[model samples]
Target chain A: MHIVICIKQVPDSAQIRVHPVTNTIMRQGVPTIINPYDLFALEEALRLRDAYGGEVTVLTMGPPMAEDALRKALGYGADRAVLLTDRYFAGSDTLATSFALSQAIAKVGETYGAPDIVFAGKQTIDGDTAQVGPGIAKRLDLLQLTYVAKIASIDLAAREIKVERRSEGGTQMLKSRLPCLITMLEGTNEIRRGSIEDALGAARSGVLKWSAADAGIEDLTRCGLRGSPTVVKRVFAPAARAEKAVQIDTAEKTLRDTADELMAAIFTRQPALEHELAFNSGA
Target chain B: MSTVNRETPRPAAGRAGIKKELPDHFKDYRHVWVFIELERGHVHSVSFELLGEGRKLADKLEVQLAGVVLGPPGEAIGNAIAEAFAYGADIVYIVEAPLLADYRNEPYTKAMTDLVATHKPEILLLGATTLGRDLAGSVATTLQTGLTADCTELDVDTDGSLAATRPTFGGSLLCTIYTLNYRPQMATVRPRVMPMPQRADKPVGRVIQHKLSITEDEIVTKVLGFLPDSQSATANLAYADVVVAGGLGLGAAENLQLVKNLARAIGAEYGCSRPLVQKGWVSADRQIGQTGKTIRPKLYIAAGISGAIQHRVGVEGADLIVAINADPNAPIFDFAHLGIVTDAIRFLPALTEAFTRRLSPHNRDKLAS
Candidate 1:
């Protein structure tokens, strides 16, 4: 079996902050990490490879610096890494992204091997759109299973795979044919640290690089901004409220006293809450 | 007015510019359509919320608002149509077949795309739930149109384009996206992000039924079974009247008990910020943020949460917000109605004791006074 996992390098969103005056994201000095969600997908792919005796290839589309993300996946026991980078791919939205990726995935099949399963994170934190995985599945004609909490079973001979998918109010046990795209949900499993041997092997292995042309993207317009149907008209910070939080004085007061004072302030601002809480608690 | 940031690269000028006029074929695309998500014989509340929002856009554009329902042929479909009209839909478009009973991407995508082809809609809205996201992505890709996901705001621009506003760059910034030339502009809003519209007793109007072209034998993916989450395990945080949530500042996994204790003391639902879910200290369902549940409780008590924009957007709709954090400059204080600077690990227990004493049956009468 051959499994391909898509990964992305994203800025650590937790560390991202907006400029107080400029009201713009301060991208400078912010560190980039492998998208936290993708790690779950990568780990799941590795586990599948280990169980089914297959090769796992990690793929990413980004700037040259994204090679680091591919290498990191390599260290995590993926057999090969592919980087699809091109100048034309900049400013691409989710639709254009899936187009480029689906084309690249087809090329990967020709060069590496036909993959039985493709893995991706449920969504990237930076975008949080959760569209590209389904988009790729639709473009490639692959069965898409998203928010997969667990792979219940996979029958390699029958090309059947069953997964526990997270839905709105319940878990759907879905069984689909192989050659499917699976987007793993976060917190399903913890990512394992790379062994020293694995790290050394990853550091030594050369990453395979492919441009849009090399990836067999026949339509140049569809690869980037030109093909992107959605245009971002403006980006701005959320407006701040007129009044800042009223500070409840805690200095020189006992913890209980401070708590009482805070509760009093809350009740004063929203008297209905106190009554409601009293009713609920008495019940 | 805000200046456009350099990091947000605009579409290039000239041939690829967004200023290009809508193609003549798409000029006839008229009404606004909201995909009424029906599963297991019930309509998700988010569908009604989208209708409420779509009604606004439709009113602005002076066009009709239609509800699109694709489900099994049964009384559920009839009930959904009636509810759609009550929730402000002027027209109802439905495709009923056993193939669409359970959401299989192939059949639903085919039905939705076929409907769009037959009756063009300029703007399409859907709830950003799991089912909606799965269907919207495939439908949009198949149609070769634009789709924005998890939009916090939906409006019609001056030029009649759908301006879908959503958090980008991990909720650090908000970007307004427009599908300039796409015939059926698509977007999905998360549940509880938009206010639910008032439902009135209105007779169903102009029902248009479409045929599902696919059969069960043609569908590859099969739903073997479904396991509903136990009532106790599910967090009803979105509709809770009072919510208490913790953050990374709780320090240890065991520290979460303090948060729950306080919530219990006040008979409130408990949750945590995204970091707690990421760290596996809490389940994803209990996460309160843009990427998680967008809650609109009456009273929200955030303990030790720094109130990142992601978390802020989720709870900002609360009637009153009270933030407790050790850092004096925490962003939660900016919007929290009341702020208390102290260690959450220590403060949480004290607050719980205070509430427990105040709300105990004997003291309840005194509190009521």
Candidate 2:
């Protein structure tokens, strides 16, 4: 079985800081890493390859710098890495990004072997839009299973795969055919550490770089800002609250005293909550 | 608010100056539609919340608000239709089929895209639940329309286009997005982002029944079975009246018990920050943050959490927020109503003991003092 896992490089959101005066993201010093959610997908794909004995290909659509993410995946035992990068693909939203990525995936199928499965993260930290995986599935006409918490079983002869999909209040055990797209939920598995030899091999490996044209994207308009239907009208910081929090004195007070004082302050502020708690405790 | 950036210009240069007329084909697209998500036998409350929001947008655009229900033919669907009307829908679209009994992408997508094609709705709103996201993504892609996910706010601009606002840059910034040229501008709102609309006794309105054209054999994905989460594990944190959340400052996984003990003493739900979930100490559903559950409890007690913007956005809506941390400069204090700069590990048990003593049946009267 051949599996293609799509990944993205995003700024480490935890390290990202907003400029207080300018109210813009301070992008200069923010380091980039593989989108955290995508790592779970990569690790899952690597595990499947290990068990089922198939090739795993890592795919990403971003600027040239995204090669680092591909190489990192390669270190994690991905057999091949493809970087779909082009200036034309800039400013693409989920719809356009999925269009480009789907085209690239189709190209991967033709160049490499046909893949039985396509994997993506449930969502990206930067965009946090979980639409691209399904968009790719629709464009490629593949079955889509999202928020998959576990791969329960795979019947290679039947070309069937079963997974436990995370739902609102429960888990749904779903079975789908091969050549399906899956967006993996986070914390499903811990990514493995690469062996020293594998890390060395990844460092020397040359990523297969593809432009939009190389990825079989014929329609340039649909490749970028021109194709994207959604337009960002404005981005700004949420207004700060008028007043800062009131500090409860804890320096000289004992822990019990502090707790009592805090409770008193809370009851004073929200008398209704105190009454509700009283009613609840009495019951 | 100072506008930091405009990420994308309108598609056409000249059309950008004026409110570009929607293609003549899409001009006929009218009304707003909310996909009423029916799972198991109960309708998700997020659907009703979206209807509440859709009501406002529908009224603003001078269009009818419609609730689209696609489920098996049963009391669930029937009750969902009635609830939609009582919530705010002026019209209800029904597509009942056994194929749609459990949400498979193929049939549900077919039903929704067919509904949009036949009776055009300019805007479509869905809850950002697992099922909704799965359906919305496929439907929007098939129709080649734009869809924004996890929107915190939705409104109609002066030109009558849907302006969907959501947190960006890890909740440090907010961006307003518009699907200018697409018909049925689509968006999904997280469960608790919008206020639940007041339900009223109203007669059901016009019902438009559509056909699900796909057969069971045509669908590739099948539901083998469903395992409902155990009652004790489910975190109904989004709608809880009182919430207590812990973060990495708790130091160890076992210390999460402090958070739960306090919560139990006060009859509140307990949760943790994203890191604890990432650390596998807590379940994903109990995470309180931008990528997790958004909550608006009456009283929120955050212990040991240095509030990042992501976590702040989720709980900032609480009526009263009390933050306890070892460091005085933790960001949680910035937005909290009351803050105690004390170590949560040491202070939690004392607070729990105090609440247990103050709120016990014999001492309940003391709370009033």
Q: Best candidate per lDDT, number?
A: 1
Residue-wise C-alpha lDDT for candidate 2, range B171-272, written one tens digit per residue: 667877889888989999888888888999899889999988889888888899988899877778898999999999899999999999998889899999
How many clashes (backbone atoms < 3 Å, residues ≥3 apart in a chain or on different chains) does model 2 have? 0
Candidate 1 lDDT by residue in tens digits, B1-369: 011111453433422355787899989999999999999899999999999999999999999999999999899999999999999999999999877778777888999999999999999999999999999999999999999988888888788888888888888878888888887999999999988889999987999989888888888999999999899988899999999999988999999999999998898999999988878899888999899999998899999999988898898889899999999988889899999999999999999988888788888878657
Candidate 2: CAPRI quality band: medium
DockQ of 1: 0.60
Please give, for residues A56-154, the per-residue lDDT of candidate 2 as tens digits.
Answer: 999998888889989999898898999998888877888888899999999999999889999999998878889999999999988899999999999
Mind giving the per-residue lDDT tens digits that candidate 1 earns over A145-221?
Answer: 99999999999999999999998789999999999999998888888898888899899999999999999998899
| Candidate 2: segments with Cα more than 4 A from true spot | A279-283, B1-19, B252-254, B326-331, B365-369
> Of the candidates shown, which would achieve the greatest DockQ relative to the real structure?
1
Docking class of 1: medium
Worst 10 residues of 2 chain A by lDDT: A274-283
